[model samples]
Target: MTTKNLLVELFVEELPPKALKALGEAFSTTLADSLKASGLATAHSAVTAFASPRRLGAHISAVRSQADDKPVSQKLMPVGVALDAAGQPTPALLKKLGALGFDAGAVPQLKRQPDGKTEALFLDVVVKGATLADGLQKALDEALARLPIPKVMQYQLADGWTSVNFVRPAHGLVALHGADLVPVQALGLTSGRETRGHRFEAAIDPVMLLDADHYARQLLEQGAVIASFADRHAEISRQLRAAAAREGLTPIDDAALLDEVTALVERPNVLLCRFEEEFLAVPQECLILTMKANQKYFPLLDAAGKLTNRFLVVSNISPADPSRVIEGNERVVRPRLADAKFFFDQDRKKTLASRVEGLAKVVYHGKLGTQGERVERVRAIARAIGERLGGTALAADADTAARLAKADLLTDMVGEFPELQGIMGGYYARADGLGETVADAIEDHYKPRFAGDQLPRNDVGIAVALADKLETLVGLFGIGQLPTGDKDPFALRRHALGVVRMLVERQLALDIDALIDTAVKTFGPLVADPARTVGLVVDFMFDRLAVSLRDQGYGAQEIDAVLSRRSSRVHEVPRALAAVRAFAALPEAASLAAANKRVGNILNKSDAPPAAAADPARFVEPQERALFDALQAASAPSAAAFERGDYTASLQALAVLKAPVDAFFDGVMVNADDPALKANRLALLASLHAAMNRVADLSKLAA
Candidate 1:
């Protein structure tokens, strides 16, 4: 059958901007997949997706008008049930054949095949092909049903009380194959070669599409719209940069903001707009957040990344004289900025100390107490960790920062913008004459809010951040509010990951187990079950660490080798992993790894621990004595290297015993006839195992 390109579109009212891109992708992909599965499109067919503020469309190349017939094997029934004792047809067989429009004459052509454990009779037949009309209808219905719409609306059609549910009220449907329209219905509308475009700037309303291949071109030339989402996004990005470049400034790099702007416009016209320079007096974060979140604008930055008075607006319409558009946006944004400034100024009148008492009224969690109680717990944990890392001075700074960290939760600025809790606290700290160390600590306590985000910049910040995350994790786990599947209401995974990054990246001397203990102890009587909760929290942190390691490109075996030890000192994990990777590359590594596994198996099968160390006087075989001497000689340098944290060198120093280990295993049996000799050999193997696995368990490297 000859094939033709196909195009389909659904035109509607303005879509939700944040979900437009995803909706377009899901619609086009699901449609293409359904067509391919039904054999109406081949594997090599090309699919293009088009989306804008008013429409979603898909264009697929090399689609067939009819799918080819396929031969199918149909299992009739078990042979035992289909035939009589003499192998003649029975009533059951005759009834089954009759239902299939067949007679006894067709039995001679039937094939017998094994089905599970019984022989079954099968009939071979050709299934009819589907026409383009039926196939396209099914594909369109599947695509609409599978769309990832967050919410749907139910509205009545033009016919009195008949209603349909969709993401939005559909106004039209377009489906075309080559130059002809395909008959398909959706949302009480039939397919046509007509779609509406840019409501204001379109040169033609209800734009007439000529053919499947001319949809995009016709829409662009006559409809005054850029139909492709990606093309529109790239065009807006280019214009924003070009406009910003002329002023010697750079636009803020926010992909999400760019995407939302692209979804808000059908024909993008980037224009430069500005707010009063006086607005720059506020912190750039507040100004940028207000402009981007409240007004959907992009704030420009100087070379030093300082916020500028001028910003860019992506307007849907482009007129000859654009001053009015710029003025209109500026006028709308000024009051928002003024409100932010008012909040900031009024908040500074009272100190953080005064606001600290107000936290008692704010509930953190029902099971857990108020934010005030949580702050006290964080302060205790932070001070304890600080004292371990630095001394009294660091502890004092961390304690002070932790106490006031949540004070901003009561500030007017933070009340207006909950995302600015920590940020506003830092500003208030600076204005209150607190040192930069305390201010930075308060600001950075929420560091690493997501994956790939930076950790705290200083020791004080690290201490407080660690305390805050630990408190959340332990408190939630204690109350049985652990994350299950994907429902992480409190983002416990992120908190656990934040703890992992700080400990590993900072190379802190504190142990993961010890830190959990500290956080639990600080909660005092609040934690319901500290012992069980500590175990759960520890396991949770390790799981997060494994995920983090995998994301960094380490293989499973290498991770298992090091993590099997379950070392409390998580800071040493990276160096330990590096050591194991180096050791696995040696020529004798396979033999040594296997031998280490064998030795471990031998030691574990014994009834009890070896009573004494291996003695040279009891060594009767030459290979056994050779292995003992080699281990004695290699012990010093390996021990010295491990003491100084040279994990790679420590593991490498023991590679010299590979030959002796192989020979000793081959020449001697660990379980000898004599009890004393057996104990001696087991002791010798135990010594070798200890020295080899100091960095990582070599047995884990065995296949």
Candidate 2:
């Protein structure tokens, strides 16, 4: 029943910077979970993960040295099959007992239990608990096996003949229960108290850990390393902000860059460094990206949020006079900035218009032709959409923008950093003497590249953006390269969601169906059945829309109701949803929804279609007459409000029909004995159904 704190560590060469945090968290969580599963730790046990450039480890508190013995009962076999008719042990029974490390004398100890139609013999045994050493070894193995390693390295062990595969070359392993070494081995190394730290600046060569709880402190004081990834990240952030604050500047905020830097250094020392001011002539995006992506430095920004000539470097070592470190970082970063500047200067020398022809040589997809052909299709779609949105000026700008959007792909700067594709295009378009509208559209066409990202800025941008996304969706779906399961190699889902976001968020007047048809026609014979392709792509976009709406906090029923109308104008979805929510809150909402569902069912089962307008003269029953009058009163105002885009008002106006609709269903039979009466009732119900559903299908709200 003794409990103790535990520590485990795996020392190795520097780990992958980007994957280190995940690896550390996974190792600790999986190891602790395994221990708890095996009853070696209780639910209240606490675990702390530690990760650095050279090590991954965990410290767990309140872990039991050994699990308690447990009583177990296992079914052996049916009673008939285990023993003979004489109540003696048969050969089968003897064999089963022997397999379980039992002898013939143990036969009488077996218990008989009912198992459905037959009674089965059960064996009862007390299982011995696992010692800390044994349990820790199994947990260690499991944790190592489950690590999310980006890649594995194969290296020879100390024995030279033996080799192992791991994220890095494992040089040491440490396992301790309290102050006692648990003596577990992994990666060809045995557990020990000694672990190396800070390859160059450790106060001691092999910093010996005193106890399980002292791991982090010892590493920091004697080993000169910040062992916790989160702590190291926070420390580096603090230093960067403080250092930048002194100069009245701010470090660029990038979580990914911060994480990568944290993993690259064991001990962080933030120092300021500067580049030549002339290099700032190139876009700050170019300079910031080069420094952060290539050199892992944090770029400083001025008050206007413009990139400054200075940047911050997170050094792994600290010296007495840090000027050398600052100068060293500055010296190293100059060439990287120079390369970016060189690429920018070289790229601007040639106009984006000149690169259009080169796109034909670059393949977009094996089946979908080249980027050049894709551009033409996009231009066609963009022009069509723009013409519908605005007359001629907008179409011209959109066409120009769509044609040049991908031209930057061939440029030196973009070729070096593909992430700068659309951004560089905007810059180059302006240099080509294209106006701001065209340049902005060229840049913003790829807007909303990811979830929660911004959409296109202007009307022209919206047109080109829609065209680009539709081209990808239509082209890929046309070639039967549809995404299945989790494998969306072409990011078609993102494209679809992007389209949905633009239509709904921007409130574009363009019809989705018409847009799809325009895009399909642009592809020509490439699509075997343009109609079918259009249908598939539209459905896919709707599916993405449902998910997006759900993520935005709309209920499943609300979304289902709104989408059921298949309203061509996706931009009106939000308004429709708002109306549905407002309607749902009404006291009469549920009854009206239920009545709408019943009315639909009756109309669907009718022998013939209902009349376009109900004949009030044919209403034989008083209830039918009353409902028809109510429908007329509600329909007029509701139709007017709906046309005016006041969806909530339109739906609320229909609330007056709740009483008349309830009375019609209660006192009148829709399928009356007389054919004329039934037809008249069907027509009356049809009118009511249409009136209630102008905003959304109320039947979808029925329980």
Candidate 3:
């Protein structure tokens, strides 16, 4: 079987920058996968993806011209149905064989095999494989059908009456197998050896590709285009660093922005541009965001990490003069920076306190009332949390921060850039002379807006952050606005995960359930059912916590063993998980876990509660006496260590009961036919169960 490297390209209008990377990845992988599935490509086939603003392509190595033919034995039908009692083919069998391209003469090749309870007749035949043209066409069709297109546009083709739907207008399609042209058609375009290069800078109007192996080289050398997205990105990074290094400044690092810029240009040419120093009077965040978001430029930073007026521009064309390109970019960025500065200047004209009244007109949610109302609820929750975490001063600061947190929503700065909500508020807070604690808290309240994001830096911020997230969780849960699988329009799961991170990572001594209750009360009548919503929100948070821990590499049983207790001390959960993991590795762990499971089953089936302590005089069995003594000795050390918060040592202390527990269950009949003896034994077993499960439910680890 002869194999060749294949190259395929689809040229279209410029793609959506943010989606280009995903589109490119999906295109190459899906095409290669479809080829492999059809047996045209093997597991060793090497695939490289090419993506630019106007094209998506793939280069695959070791693709066979035609797949290998294979012999297949296919079942026809049951013997009784296919043949008569005369042991000859029936009319139905003849019809089936005719449809399968077989005939009466081929019936001699039929074999019998037992299928379930009946025997079936099978036919063995050699099947021809798909040729390169057919396989590549099928692969291309599938790849286009599933490109993760963000949006589709329907336009009429050149025929005027026929229409096609695609992410962008399709202009060209290229399909080459080594030096040979594979006949394939897509979007009304036939495969060709011609493809256009850069829109403006290509040396040739259309670069004539020679073979599959030279596609990338020809594009870069003669076409002024970097065909590989990864190569283009690395080239841009290298140029940006080199351009910024001349002035002893560093380019602001943003992966998303870099990827978007790479998608915008075919070949990158990094150039330095600058803005007026007066614009630097505004917050660096405002200037940086305006440049990056609006202009797609990288801001430069000094050695001290302070934003500088100079920025780097990734130009699509490298002009000999280059001064005009630099000037044009600088001119384009000036207005955007001016708008940011104007918004900042107009915002700080009034203190954050003045904006508090304006939030009443801003709706936080339809069911949750206005932002003003939400702010009041947050203030109450924050005050309560602060009072618990600290004494008096922390509570006062938390209340102030919570009240002013959403006030920035009404400011001109935040209205122009919503991502700067909390950040701008911090700037305004300081300008109003509200002190560093209040300013930092206002900024840090939204600290953990995403996964791996930091938590609040101060106690005041922790209180307000916790209160804000709790209010949202409880209020939305009460309204039945919960997140479903994949569709988290409200970001409830993220909010819940944020709360979990703060509680566990911050090690705050806060009960999530109690906080939910407090938050529910603050909602007044806004929450439909406060009591029920409390439990729902608590469960959702713990579920998120379990997922977070599992993602952090903790085992399912280890997490389940700790969380099954429904303990409110979330801060202690990590330590509990650590202790459970340690206990699981002990020599006596299996027997103890199994015994703990049996004890729980026995106690659950009994009608009466086990006594707090077993009556030793009624312990008629020596096995019961021995188990009771072992449990008594184990409980003391476990209790001492638990009081000191040494969960590992505490759980490890219960290992002494394994031998006596096994003996008791093996030699003594728990239901001794005497009600009092049974009750006492239940009491003894209950005590043992309690001692073993102080940190986590040991039964969850049982096999």
Candidate 4:
């Protein structure tokens, strides 16, 4: 019925800030689970974690005083045949009941209520209570044992004692309940009522923790450390943006940088630093890369979005002279930018237009041959993709763009920094007097560099992007570089998604199998076996397409059915989805689906082989003749509509057979004694199959 606050802290040498953030969560979750398993009714809320380079601590709101006690019941099967030979309480039964804590003196009188019923009895038992500290300590110990310490080592204490292995050296441990210390001796730690302040700025030997709230405050006041990472992160962002605003420049928004910065400092001190303006003559990308990749500084940009010479650096310490730190950082970053500038200038000596021929030396992949060879394959594939979408006006231009898309890979600038691959190509292409469409395609072909990024814009760009990705996919599958769980080294998943986005967004009519075949064939002598490569590439695309469609709102089962029956005609998937939606819209569609199930059930149960129904003279009933007539009429319209990709209209035509087929099933017996009559009825079902198979195997749809 009573509750108390719980505090657990791990004190050690400096931990990587990232590890601390993750471990804080692990501690809260694992500890909560352990307490619940012990049957304690505790509200583990208000989890507060604060980590410096040295320690990680979490505080819980309230934990129950003791685990809820319940009387556990046991069933003992009666032993001893014939009950001691006198039908009495056998010695075996007495011993079994005694071992279960049932008091023999207090056993209740037995009573019988019905025939074949035995007497019922019970003995009252009470369980001992456990203290809050006992339960919490057990739970915390279990959780700590499982806490993943990426690195650990043994420690020695002054008392000539050895401690449990740990990452870095363990200094102390603090475990608290309200104002009391819960003693623990694991890992050479004496359960204490105190923890330390920030490693760099602590003035006292140790800060005493009287309570969870005061303990957190003392650490901050003594060492200038913030307890909660969320608050610290907000403060860092505020200061960095303010520092950037002083020069009318903006801080580049980077999630990875923000996360790394959060781990790099306990108390972030934002400062403005500048480089010589002459460095701005280097490309904006080159300047930013120098600051971000090398110095970990947040680059600032001018109002016009140009990279400024100034940057904002966040420091963990508030030094007496911040200007000195700024100058030291500037000295380190200047040389890096100069090197990038040198690479950029040297690369410009060879124009991107001239670099097109140089791609022949850069291998795209062993099986894919050289980048120059890939360009040739892409030129043909892009033209095919372009023509299929009715973009002939720009088809020639798309061919030109695809041919030069990877040309910049040969340039010195892109060679030094591969991230600027397509970007440098676009810049060079435009400078060489290429048309806007051609130059734009050279850049935009790599629009979706990752999942959730924007896709290529124009048809030309989309076509070329698809070509490049498909070639990679087919070539890799031919050589077996397919992805397994989380091991996509070549980013094949992104390429697959790019293909899905192109198909769904561009609305292009493409036979994916044919496209894969074209790409595989382009490999020519490079691919060992084209047939197996084509199948693997086709299957990969289907898997990726299934995932994409499910994300678009289709169920997995439906996607499997559609893909199995029509993966080759991938462009027809949208039409098929529409047909499915329309079939569901019909009021009679439900009943029709039921009828279809009945037909399949009957066919499955039938022992005799079904016969063809081409002989009309075998029809003994008028209903059978009516079914045949309707099937004939339905065939023409359905085939015509399906061929033109009008799936909804095709479904409407198939609906014409509903009445006649239902009449035949109701009036005539399919298993007739007459052989010809039985054969004709089976043929009628065969005709229905032929008609529906033209669109999709309707049998796979859910009833």
Using all chains and alpha carbons, the TM-scores for the candidates as numbered come to 0.98, 0.96, 0.98, 0.81
Whole-model Cα lDDT per candidate? 0.93, 0.92, 0.93, 0.74
What TM-score should be assigned to candidate 2? Answer: 0.96
Kindly report which residue stretches of model 2 are placed more than 4 angstroms away from their true locations once superposed: 83-90, 101-119
lDDT of model number 3: 0.93
Worst 10 residues of 4 by lDDT: 106-115
Please identify which of the two predictions, 3 or 4, would achieve the higher TM-score against the true structure: 3
lDDT by residue (tens digit), candidate 3, 596-652: 999899999989898888999998878888998888888998999999999999999
Clash pairs for candidate 2: none
Q: Candidate 4 lDDT, tens digit per residue, 1-703?
A: 7666777777777776556667666766677667666655354455666555666667776666676676643334432321456646555556656786543442333222222354333333445455666766776777667777666667676677655566667777888777777766556677787777766776664888777657677777875677666667888899988888777789999877776677677778998988889888777887787688767899987788878778999888888889898888888888888898788777767766687788788887766688888889888888877777656866787788898898888877787778888877877787788867877788889867876788876778888888888888887878888899989998888898888777766676688888888888877877888999988877777788888888889866456546767556677887777786677567656655556656666666667756654577777789878988888888888888988889889877878677887798899997788776766676677666667645555566645
Candidate 1 residue-wise lDDT at 349:
98
Off by over 4 Å in 1: none
Q: Write the per-residue lDDT of candidate 2 for residues 225-261, one digit (tens) a residue.
A: 9999999999999999999999999999999999999
What would you estimate as the lDDT of candidate 2?
0.92
Q: How well does candidate 1 score on lDDT at residue 445?
A: 98
Superposed Cα deviation of residue 47, candidate 4 (Å): 3.6
Residue 455 of model 1, lDDT score: 89
